[model samples]
Target: MSIRAAYIEKMKLQLDELNTTMDELQSKAGTTKIELQEKYLKEMASLREQSQGALDRLDELKTSGEDSWKSMVMETEKVRDAFVKSFHYFKSQL
Candidate 1:
């Protein structure tokens, strides 16, 4: 499958794992002491970091694709101009 599809699948899996972890954490929070609660918060922060990293990567990839498309359009315009100029020159020679 395409790279995009694969990336989406991976993100879905990560989301599922994060949800499960959060649920388990909430259940365990009932019995957790103050220190353990603090630790759980820290762990939750870490999980958030992971999700943020994935989102950042996705944004980067999207930006990269946009840049590539812009470059292609610029190059295509240049080629089209050159072709038009060449055609005009040939017509003028007739």
Candidate 2:
């Protein structure tokens, strides 16, 4: 596969993983106390927003030309990393 193709595939996998994590978190939140559940839901909403940002970056990367692909990749990676960090921190709180 071309570099761009491989990068896109990798991002798709990351998104799939994020979805799974979100689902698991949602399931846990359903069983928590109402007060904590409220917090969890709010954080989940933020996570979803971050996830959407990553998806948007991926879409942008898809249309970027070879000359600009590397920089786009870097930007997308930053989004992915931030999302991953937030996910881990949220998980730790549970």
Candidate 3:
């Protein structure tokens, strides 16, 4: 397969893994005190938005041509990085 196809596949898997991590974190968050749970929920909402943005970028990347796919890859990486960073920060708070 072409490098572009390979890169897209890797990103899709990364996003899937990120979703699973979020689910696990949410499960842990559920047992926190009500006050902290509210805060974690707000942060999780932001993480969800970032995850959705990454998914949206992935969809665009899938449809892009060879010439445009490189740029899409860069853009998608930015979104994915932000999501991962946010998740790490949230996890640290727990």
Which candidate gets the maximum lDDT versus the true structure?
Answer: 2
User: Could you tell me the lDDT of residue 20 within candidate 3?
Assistant: 94
Model 3, 22-84: lDDT tens digits are 998888887999999999899999999999999999999999988987787888899899888
Q: Residue pairs in steric clash, candidate 2?
A: none
Better of 1 and 3 by TM-score: 3
Instruction: Kindly indicate the candidate among 1 and 2 with the higher TM-score.
Output: 2
Count of backbone clashes, every candidate in sequence? 0, 0, 0
Order the candidate numbers by TM-score, best to worst: 2, 3, 1
lDDT of 2 by residue, 1-94 (tens): 9867998999979887987989887988879889999999999999999989989998999999999999899999999999989988988899
Query: RMSD for each model, in Å, please?
Result: 23.2, 0.9, 1.0
TM-score per candidate, in order? 0.47, 0.94, 0.93
What's model 2's overall lDDT? 0.90
Q: Candidate 2: where are CA atoms >4 Å away?
A: none
